[model samples]
Target: MCGIVGFSGKESKEILKRMNDEIFHRGPDEEGFYQDKYVNLASRRLSIIDVLSGKQPIHNETKSIWLVWNGEIYNFKELRNELLKKGHKFYTDHSDSETIVHLYEEYGIDFINKINGMFAIALWDSKNKELILIRDRMGQKPLFYSFVNNEIIFSSEIKGILKYPYYKKEPNFEALNHYFTFKNIPAPFTPFKNIYSLFPGEVLIFDVEKKKKKQFKYWEIDFLKTNNDNIEEITYNIRNLLEDSVKKRMISDVPIGAYLSGGLDSSSVVSIMSKYSNSKIKTFSLGYTTFLEHKNQDIIAARKISNILDTDHYEYFMSPQELIDDLPNVLRSFDAPFSGAISTFFLTKLISKHVKVALSGDGADELFGSYLAPRLSQPLYYFEKIYKKIKSGYQLSNEDKIKLKPFENNIKFLENLYLKSNGNFEKWKYEILLFKDEEKKRLLNNGVFEYDKFNSFDLLKKDVENLKALDPLNRALELEWKTLLPDHVLAFVDFLSMVHSVEVRSPFLDYRLVEYVASLPGNLKIKNGNIKDILKKSLKGILPDKIINRKKEGFVLPVFWWLKNELKSFIFENLNEHELKNSVFNYEYVKFLLDSYYNNKENDFKLAAKIWNIVSFKIWWDLYFK
Candidate 1:
């Protein structure tokens, strides 16, 4: 619930303040600063815990180690007791962040192993002449950093880093290529050149005196290693771990609520939350207008759960015009390129009005299994089978390649299957990218080098290679944890919520819970074509039977309907060929997407998604780069 910014080279109080001010919405309650010869650190505090004297950059008892942190350490009180036993004294009454510097003092860089929470920490060790930056094991918080003239500048968002006078303004074209492919850039790559996001479970140690840096991983989730086999026992353990995670996340001093989307994940979170709360838990859901009297089953399910739990619940339907109006604000909130724009934008704006902290079921799908993956796996497997045979003596004929080219944009899932058949890792990173390899070849101006291997998926090929021993389901889940969850889902949630100073906590993403679930056999996660089978079975008695059996529907906007009707003119105005003729996209390809949508193509949803990607990219480009 705060924004942290600092520099290790030049000391500029003005730059530090400007950097912190860029993300003022992240911490509107108060702001603090700590300047020294080699470091300038600042924090915008949201006043979540120890509202009175809990401020940053908080110093250790010796005053040599200073800390500025963004996140909630749920186990701070317990860790504090352990530190107290070791003869450590604290100044503030109940500041969760106070334990970090003391723990670092006791354990050095190994302190991260002993703590469990979502945090991005900048700990300045003046005595060692080193600055240490750490991101949580789950990557719930984001940290962006750049090295300029032997100095390292770090901040909670990219905008903060941009405030530095020496920061580079060049766009990373490789990153833009990946953005178009994955709808978001994968980790360690930002849209701007020379600026990078820290990977989850990564620890960065910078030597201020020597002007050197070392980065290494402290934690990772390994799905190749399976643990329990007893389905009943494993199910029991999962429930226990999830309940404990929810309890831990409810440690805030302010009002908290749950996002009950009527999906199994969010509903299960609300159920567990109700068990722990004596008062009615506030729940929220989102719905939209449908012309054909299409019943919103998610809203119906949400109402049923809220009524059963007897909680204060709220629902809102978003109009296309409302979303169109807020598009600019949504575009500005992202620190990097992203595509989970519409739903998250409206959902966060609605929920922030009711509570300061909200718990969500964000990681359940990635940790367990998603329907889309399994549905496409068979096609991919069959294609790979044929591909291996064909490659033995037959390569893709030019005519066949051309036939497949059109389908790439029309059915990304099928194109992904085809890509996998050819031993390409691109599909693993984004099973359905905005554009395929061949399309991007035509789209780019042919100026960038190594365009073939520029995808974020290629960067993570080692991860896929490492997990070759695991079942396909588990392998897909592991890849998602490394790519989709951190870069897109968590970033979207963090940006939208922080825009309104609302902190979103995901119990499903707790490292312990994630690891435990990952260790379970993939068969339990998905069985007989059913996704999240174990999760659904586990919730049998706890939730209403109807809710448990509900069909899986994504939390997405009705963009297909809106684009052809409500927002048709808007898309035409913003995404015409004239505007994009001088840009990176191929004018014909862009025209094809819009023309197909307008003409009501066979794959209408695919066409709509393509349109959305183009519109989103154009809007973001105009706002930040233009």
Candidate 2:
């Protein structure tokens, strides 16, 4: 799976083949290039591993280090046997992009701390003319750079750095006010204007003869560190680090499968990929034709775990007019304006017609305690242990009504999580925002929120104010691994599964199983109220207690009963007010969120998620700057 692009100043090599033909559907099998006089590099190859001489910008032997990767490093044959026992000269008999230019010729930019997977790389050295770039460490591949004039560029989608030619399209508007308060757009921000987002375990570097650049962070997932172990040794070390991250993502060459949405994170990743496959294991699930197979319990619990794991199963339903007729191919396969999980782009376009790698349980609910803002993390430490047992009035049971069921009947949302949660992260950032901040100050149009901090929960409010000493369920699972598990669920599952080129591998994003379920103790990743109760005791007896206690099944979409029946004139023909008049929304507050979503009458689903998040930001502002 590849699709990289390059640049590093004095452009022209025909703008790197028009920036590698704008991500040719993220690598249409093969493509490569590498330039000199300080970097040009390119790649598009989607021929999984070593597909006959695994080519790319790959280099080393006197080639002064060149590279081009996109992803899939599942420990490249144990980093090519420790870079072929340090001798380090290999071509391609088995290439993980040739152990990253011989581990950057023996750890020079500290070879991204001995590589794990999900990459973005670029490499290029031209003998220290520099030009690194990286992303992985569980941001699951997405690079996008810029720096202009004094050149930088980089790619792997932002339409391959908008084919540079002295690029200048401009739109950021503080990343569209954090995409209407984080429906997506929270990374090193980029809805254009000097493109950014190198984030996720970053690396930058640059310096093409001191035009300079540095950037940092080698890796993260701290969650205010705490591990005393024992819950049977953290569920036997989280089922032996998620079965060695699903056997190193089944180290692919081609067909692989497992998006089994029968809950419990892809049914414990298809029951450890049907106990390490040898056959009959292809599984996939999706259902919706407007619910009612008991709200189509996620394809009836994935066709009852495909008849209790006998395997080879498939299901499809969709229809809300084929999800509003695949809204312009799932909102133009996102360059931005993706409101995460749009049926993971029709279940990775039906697992790219049956597999080119799938396996995803996507970071087991931001590394445990499946969201309710991380099971409303120790709200006042379980509201002062049930407020000192009703202030010595004792006798409250059923585990004190399951620790007062997340502040039962919301007494002003538990008095704003008991007087605005400690060191106030604005009530756990308004319980994981989906648009607030007084409704994005009554639907934007307030002159580009003064060009910056328009309170999109103060963009991770200074990393949730330096995790204020953890235990608010590891500070809401370390601010959901810094903003919704890597800028909106691994950036819409790596831009909707490589825009249908398909290659989604998240063995619960193994950064050593997210640093051992983020060092355990968030009272065993949610207890009493039982949200991801330590990943259901690490799948007790390898599943089957009704699939390890089901229930955290999100990905439900009916869109508030199709915005008041059959996509109500297809959501006011892409949100009216004459196509958002002079753009930047506020059509009398999108007509008061479409008249309180069709005069209420019930089922609001957060006002159909803010009128389909402003009709998917006016179909991605009429598909990139109307």
Give candidate 2's whole-model lDDT. 0.78
Model 1 spans with C-alpha error above 4 angstroms: 290-295, 378-431, 445-457, 460-463, 466-469, 601-603
lDDT of 1 at 204: 95
Give the whole-model CA lDDT for all candidates, comma-separated.
0.80, 0.78
- Candidate No. with top TM-score: 1
Each candidate structure's TM-score, on Cα atoms with residue i matched to residue i, is 0.91, 0.34
* Candidate 1 accuracy as TM-score: 0.91
> How would you encode candidate 2's per-residue C-alpha lDDT over 1-626 as one tens digit per residue?
88898887654678899889888878888888877767788888888788999888888888888888888888888888987888888978998888888988888888788888888888877766888888887788888888887888888888778867779887877777777767878778878788988888889888898888989898877765676767888788888889888988988877798888788888888888888888877887777766555457777878888788888987766778887777766666667776556778776787888777788888888878677776666654666556545557665566555765665445346545555554255555665577867767778776633333566665567767766445677777787787778888777777777888888888888788888788777777677667778778878988788867867667656566666878888888777888777767768888887988788788687778778887877787777777
Model 1 has an lDDT value of: 0.80
* lDDT tens readout by residue for model 1, 463-517: 5666543566676777777878889888888887789888999999888888888
Superposed Cα deviation of residue 467, candidate 2 (Å): 32
Among residues 3 or more apart in sequence or in different chains, the pairs in candidate 2 whose N, CA or C atoms overlap within 3 Å are none
